[model samples]
Target: MTPTSLNTGVNEKKRSEWLQEVSAHLVESYEVTESGKNPIKRVFFEEQEAPLSILSHVWDEYDTYAEATLHWLYELAEGQNFEVRLKVAETVGQLATYEFLPVLRKILSPWAKSGKPSVQRLAALALAVVAYNEQEHIAQQALNLVDHWSNLKTSSSLQWTAIAAYGGYIGLLVPEKALDNLKIIAQSGNGKLFSDIAKAVEKLFNAGVQIPKLHGLVLNTLREWVDQGENTSVYRLSLLIFRGLMRKSWIVKNDIRQPTLLWLAKESKDFEDPIVYLMRNGLNLGSRRDSILAEILNWLEFVDRHPTLYKTLARIIFTLAASSGNERKRMCYYLKIWSINSQTAIQILNLINKHL
Candidate 1:
């Protein structure tokens, strides 16, 4: 026999033996129970390692074992336990290799149709992971599947999950295309769909995934929607997204923040509902409170004219001040300082004190 063929045969035998040993160890170590406890949770709740850890170690140490581990995970995903299935979906997603795409597709297709939001969301995320593969054909296939899921007319729940998954992964691959898709989705004027888009954007930022021009693209799109005044749902949804972006100071650039505040000021004139909603929900700005307050103060010239919005902003500042002693002191100092130079700030300080 050729030396190369001889070596291949020996390696194949070793791989088979190693896989067999790992499989046996997994079966013996982790017991899937009727209690529906996720195998992954065993590591935390029972303080014992589970088969997932062993499979991860195998996949990491031995490249050839990746395929075997995926197949094993696919089987585990079919089990009756909901948490186990969700965890398996997550683990498969983290694998994020082209080789896992076919198996994951098989596992996720049924899940996409399962009519369970949690299952569908997990499936969406797992299926989207294939977009991370470097192979052109594989990534295209993943994108195609997401497009199909998002376009499913009969199921809005499925569409929501697909939008979220698309939001999470597509920007990493094609920022312009992602923005275009989001804009088209927004045009549907479905309020729930708009919420999913906002959530997807929040998920993208929360995960700290950097995509060039994506933030600007999203901001511009929302600005255009608010500017058009064609759809009240879109206008309201845009404000919701603006609030989410503003809460994260690092994500809110000066250019974006200025336009957003302007939109809020303009919308506040006619739409107290969305404006009040933004104020009540958007106050968790953490350290960005100072900059955001300063920006709003800059608009005191305009906001001072709108009584409803003025009162809402004052209440939001009061809510921030009441959150803690440090914040109260900070707000007190800012209110005192700004109150000297601005009538609006003085009014806000008076309003806040009335509440305290």
Candidate 2:
């Protein structure tokens, strides 16, 4: 009837049995069930997170066939087919270990633009899935899409897609082209958009990517935290400072981590966020399995020494305690006790109260 309401007259067709062969092979390597009696959902959510290597393997195989499967995935990414789109987004994201960036960038953006919220969310989320692989150009494309959403010329769902993309790309070091734009958005955005902007600020320094006024911005922001805003604003601002400190740790070079950690310990005393903040930082840098574990042990000793940091440290622990799965939960716990939670201040002395 109407342009917006026009529906494609395509018939509902069953998925090709090609998936059967692929799914069977995928199950063996990924140790996952091939049956969609929940398939990808069963693996990503209902089960524990898999190792990066296994996911890498899955990515390899998926990429090998993605071009051939692209048509079906289109059925999933759009075709006005909700479940298909969600799975394509989800499964593809899990194995997002390749250069499918161009395809994702070219093909899916419109789908995210036109699809229903649920479908859009999945499409946007799939865009986010490749973020951790240090895929900057791809990530920038996502940032561009997010920036478009912030224009408010699109649907609110599109805006949320943008927000999630912003947050997802937070793992990326802020690119120069998107830097100022993101700052403008973060400082002024509403709802989850605000959270994303806050994270962009946080990751700008941490990603070890250069931003314009990073050094001055980092120290000044930390100093300014002594001044204030909303509680979240205060926390995020402090977190940006602290995460900046962590990001710059290799350069800080003079027991700076200790003092900064001590300052945060005092400023955010009785708060667990700073602790968790430290842990997440450690985990992100955790490419080596030994490094993460060793880092965990180091933080454990730090936690044990700082009896006063307990209350806030407790928050750090509790927050991550409800992790989405085991590896994430385990890594969160390890970081919490050793680096994130432990690296900061375990002795929750009243830094904020004393200073404020």
Candidate 3:
């Protein structure tokens, strides 16, 4: 069975006529709904693609027809076909602007409540697209959904869908509350959720919105991740925020202190975040790991003073100097420390220097 009826089972002429009807309404479509048309099925699924043509065609007619068609747009979700559903979602996503954000939000409510994971996911995806479209929704609807979606769970494919969706949420909405939620999720090290959240935040920071408030939110969120329980890879995100923050001169060493300390502990021998697969060994750890020097210094100090953790500290430092980008800063810095304590540092230094 087909998931959705893209063709409306109508002849090409009928479909073409329907498309023309919608195209003529233009801005007047919203007025139609206000005039009490209340069309339950708002979307014209079969007539996707050349969307502007259809929209323009209806634009001159009764705007009511277009405005009332939103539910029909959402009904595309009812169709079990992935292609149809996604296309419908994409179409609605296109319509997700300030004028229609509330309608989009209403359209998505079904997925929020429905047990069908794909439907819910498509809803999220639609919102992501909406967020990306600058002329569309200002992001409030998407922002609201991100928080709503964070606490919800689904299948592996859904998780994959979520990975980028949540990222888009942060990137587009830039809502402080939603960003805060992401921060907490990242900090919790909810092993399952962090990777997705961290990855998303990284993408958002790179997407380039010159909102200082958003920038500060991103930095603080990273700091929250560090304090909560960040893994090494997560530090990649932390560093991104850190680097960005550094340029703004908004975040200082005080900001780096706690998160950097947590990152150090992750590199420490006993308590590493579950995702540190890089320790498996490869080439060198040269310029690539420049930011890590600050972390290595913290680890060294923690271990040196603790004495009990000296062995774990030694292993981490040794690992650092041997990794792909450890040549100048990381290895050299460690070598300096070893030079001071030739007795124990010599052996580990020699092995690490091999990589450098």
Q: Per TM-score, what order, best first?
A: 1, 3, 2
The prediction achieving the highest lDDT against the true structure is 1
TM-score of each: 0.51, 0.36, 0.41
Task: Compose the digit string of candidate 1's lDDT tens values, residues 14-132.
Answer: 64466555453222124455776344323332223445566556766898876676566656644445765656776666564535555555566666666666666677667666676
- Measure candidate 2: CA RMSD: 16.7
Instruction: Give stretches of model 3 more than 4 Å off.
Output: 1-49, 56-68, 78-83, 135-141, 144-164, 169-179, 185-224, 229-349, 352-356
Q: RMSD to native for every prediction?
A: 12.8, 16.7, 14.9
Q: What do the candidate models score in CA lDDT, each in turn? A: 0.58, 0.47, 0.50
Q: Write one digit per residue (lDDT tens) for candidate 3, span 309-352.
A: 45655665555444456343646656667558443455456656
Clash pairs for candidate 1: none
Worst 10-residue lDDT window, candidate 3: 274-283
Error of 1 at 65 (Å): 16
Question: Candidate 1: lDDT over CA atoms?
Answer: 0.58
CA deviation > 4 Å runs, candidate 2 = 1-71, 74-107, 114-143, 169-171, 175-182, 186-189, 195-356
Q: What is the lDDT of residue 10 in candidate 3?
A: 41
130, model 1: CA deviation in Å? 1.6
